[model samples]
Target chain A: MSDEKKLAIIATKGTLDWGYPPFILASTAAALGYETQVFFTFYGLQLVRKKLDLKVSPLGNPGMPMPMGMDKWFPVLGTALPGMESVMSSMMKKKMRDKGVASLQELRDLCFEAEVKMIACQMTVDLFDFNPADFVDGLEFGGAATFFEFAGESDICLFI
Target chain B: MAAFDQELDATGLNCPLPILRAKKTLSGMEAGQVLRIVATDPGSVKDFEAFSKQTGNELLESGEEAGKFVFLLKKA
Candidate 1:
């Protein structure tokens, strides 16, 4: 492996839980003094949105865990509940807070300060009707070729 | 012999932050420099462990004091 490394993170999910992985890894890589970039596509672009992407709640996923024990294991009952995703999302947020993990916003800010590159997928942006101005400052626009070109030189590539 | 002396006070900061700061600090140092970090976040222990593994930095000593965690790192 090269002593100096580059990393590319592909973000495709918009949920709070899903969002943490990419930010966490990307920030960590930047902290390690590696050249890092996070490419947001599809729903993942929500994170770059100035307001709509902040604090996403999993409101509709039924596979989320129940409040108490045992009920989580029941087969069909688990799938029938509403707001299960919200519960899971809250649980994840709580766990992170309790464990002293940085907030999503803090991680993002740290990444920017550390000069980690952030990119948005142009096709997804157009499809979602997202204005480039709606995203955080310093977001670049590109597609798969852009991502591949960046990833090809990196020692590590992660899709989250 | 002292390689180099650096201190990072990450008290009240969280997991990745401590490790993050440690990484940034180490990056500017030459091999064999020593870094001392004090943190209040509990997850820092595990975070540093993983950091040492991933970055090849050596954790010379780590322990708890006055409800705070302290780590001595040797850049490798």
Candidate 2:
């Protein structure tokens, strides 16, 4: 085998908060000259969609801090309010922008430019009845065995 | 004010972006050419060091000026 390192990641979440780690790590790995592949399974397949509609939900996320001193006094009840998720999602997006953290689309674009392999799980697509045309161009569709072929030889394998 | 063949301004970008930019820029440069980069992300200080070690690029200088992190990298 070649001496170049390999990185394999299985992306299993679709939430905006959870969507970042896989792309960030994969892009950085590609930047470092590692052969990188990301397998998007289940809800994670949303990341490869042509139009991204990711959102973060504050409900049941105790670690998420509420704005305006609400975290200390408001408890989890406030999260139950209608449209709370959209509110939290917008706030998180603003924070990321202010901190200069790359948006999910930007990170994905970097990965694409760096030639990182992005594979979407075919099983999940069939289960969800998703149209293959809904995803971005240059994506590969495969099953678990296909991912295992690369992951088995990877120096670093992550499930995120 | 170090002499460099190229310069990359990664200001207002955070983790991974600055490094990614540097990597892309360096790939197109000739070997032995020097690249100077300025970034606002505080985390780049450590990230660049690790990047240099991993990629075999030489990190000639790493310092901060006016709160922005500066780096000089010599392509390997």
Best by TM-score: 2
* The 10-residue segment with the lowest total lDDT in model 1 chain A: A52-61
Local accuracy of candidate 1 as per-residue lDDT tens digits, B1-76? 2334898989877757898888878888889889989999888888888788777888887789888998889999
Judging by DockQ against the true structure, name the best candidate.
2
Q: Write one digit per residue (lDDT tens) for candidate 1, span A16-126.
A: 767778888888887776899999999899877776434444345455444556345655555445775565667777877777778788888878878889999999989
**For model 2, what is the alpha-carbon lDDT of residue B37?**
98
Q: After superposition, how far is residue A131 of candidate 2 from its true place, in Å?
A: 0.7
* Docking category of candidate 1: medium
